[model samples]
Target: MPADLSHIRQVMEEADCLYSEAEVEAAIAQVGERITAEMAESNPVVFCVLNGGLIFAGKLLTHLRFPLEASYLHATRYRNETRGGDLFWKAKPEISFIDRDVLIIDDILDEGHTLSAIMDFCRHAGARSVRTAVLIDKAHDRKASPDLKADFVGMSCIDRFIFGYGMDYKGYWRNAPGIYAVKGL
Candidate 1:
């Protein structure tokens, strides 16, 4: 089902702003620093997990002063639903991962299922190394994969239904300038 535009707009108006644009940029800069320091020399193939990761990857890529090729893969556990379910692979990168250092960028780390599967996929594709990055790390103890974690994390937040900054509420609000948690969530 599609979200009501009016409700989305109303939620945006009332939702709590978690991080401002400047702060998000600063966090991305810090993440970029770590990526540059560790993976720049490896010429990694950066994979932006599609839809949600687009904005974060686009912004973060600008600060990465390295020679890395950018591509994207489409995978989703939450396809327009508030709660996550099964993983679906919509698309994969055209470039081969063989012997390549793969960097996976995502919008958020909620349960770690998608990221973990992506990491496994990259490894199965023969990637030399696989590292994950996310704009937000949802602070929850009940992760789907407990041992997995992002190599680079921009921000951490209490578990809540969140939107904005490449994350959407019913497929809207992704273009909001800052991170926001849905009101009453």
Candidate 2:
């Protein structure tokens, strides 16, 4: 069962931020350092997955000082499920990407289906290389299916559904200060 407000309040009482405010700032700084060191000279194509990845992608861009193109694709598989569901896609961005390096920024990588599909689509759309960047890597029950995984990972997660740092629970807690594990979970 989902945790009640009382339980949530209890957890909040002793709640510890997995990434404190300063930690988040420091991490963002590190992200800039890593991205610049890894892909500065590649002239990559940056793709930010819509809605959830918005916050993380924005912050990441601050550190990515390179010759790159930015685009986005809208794909989601969630309506009301906690765990990942199926797959969905929208119209791809209309930016020329033939033989160009592409980087995808996403909020989370759970089952990897949606992201894997995105990478495949980008390749088909004529991207030379498609790398991925995600704020959180939810590597739970992952099965090798397609030739798509984030070449760049910001954080690692086990399997539990979480919210915060741009992640949302039923579209509610995305703005929460600290990332939160579901209470009693």
Candidate 3:
């Protein structure tokens, strides 16, 4: 099936801008500073959760002054849809993170199921420590667990269908300059 380009454009046209580009940038910088403060000397292996994490990781990496090994993994549950299903691993970590501090970066922490699973994988693979950094943390009560939280968070947003800065809506709008919520989502 082909996507309707017109509808895609209209989605953006009608969407509500949740965060401007400058606000997103400021949030990223703040998160970068916090990550650097804690993990700069940890010799961390930073893994960007792909598709959604691409943009956030690229921008956040510049703020870290210390040296770190940067890599990416493609694990997703949404698969370009609004709702999530089972976990799908397009790519797994190819580099050895054994006995090293691991940092997982993603665009958002919605329910934390995928992120939680990734963190568990790191621990089972012998990571000395596993942490997470998310560009946006959705404020809701239905988390994967009561204690599930990102180690570093760039911003907090209400539970809405949001996209931009790596997040997508129906597999589009990931490149939108700022955060936006679908009109009725």
By TM-score, the best candidate is 3
Please give the CA lDDT of all the candidate structures: 0.90, 0.73, 0.94
Model 3 lDDT at residue 55: 97
Error of 1 at 82 (Å): 8.2
Error of 1 at 88 (Å): 2.9
Query: Which lDDT tens digits does candidate 2 get at residues 1-185?
Result: 56476654555555445665566656666766888898899888788898778878888888887777877778866655765566566556668778988888888887677788778788998989888888777765564464446677777765676777788765556766756677545
Arrange candidates by TM-score, highest first: which order? Answer: 3, 1, 2
Candidate 3's C-alpha runs over 4 A off are 77-86
Structure candidate 3, residue pairs in collision: none
Supply the TM-score for candidate 1: 0.93
- State the lDDT at 102 in candidate 3: 98
Lowest summed lDDT across 10 adjacent residues in model 1 is found at 76-85
| Candidate 2, RMSD to the unseen true structure | 3.7
For residues 6-64, write the lDDT of model 1, one tens digit per residue: 98899999999999989989999999999899987998999999889999999999988
- What's model 1's overall lDDT? 0.90
Tens-digit lDDT string for candidate 3 (62-130): 999899999999887778888888877899998899999999999999989889888988999999999
Q: By summed lDDT, which 10 consecutive residues of candidate 2 come out lowest?
A: 140-149
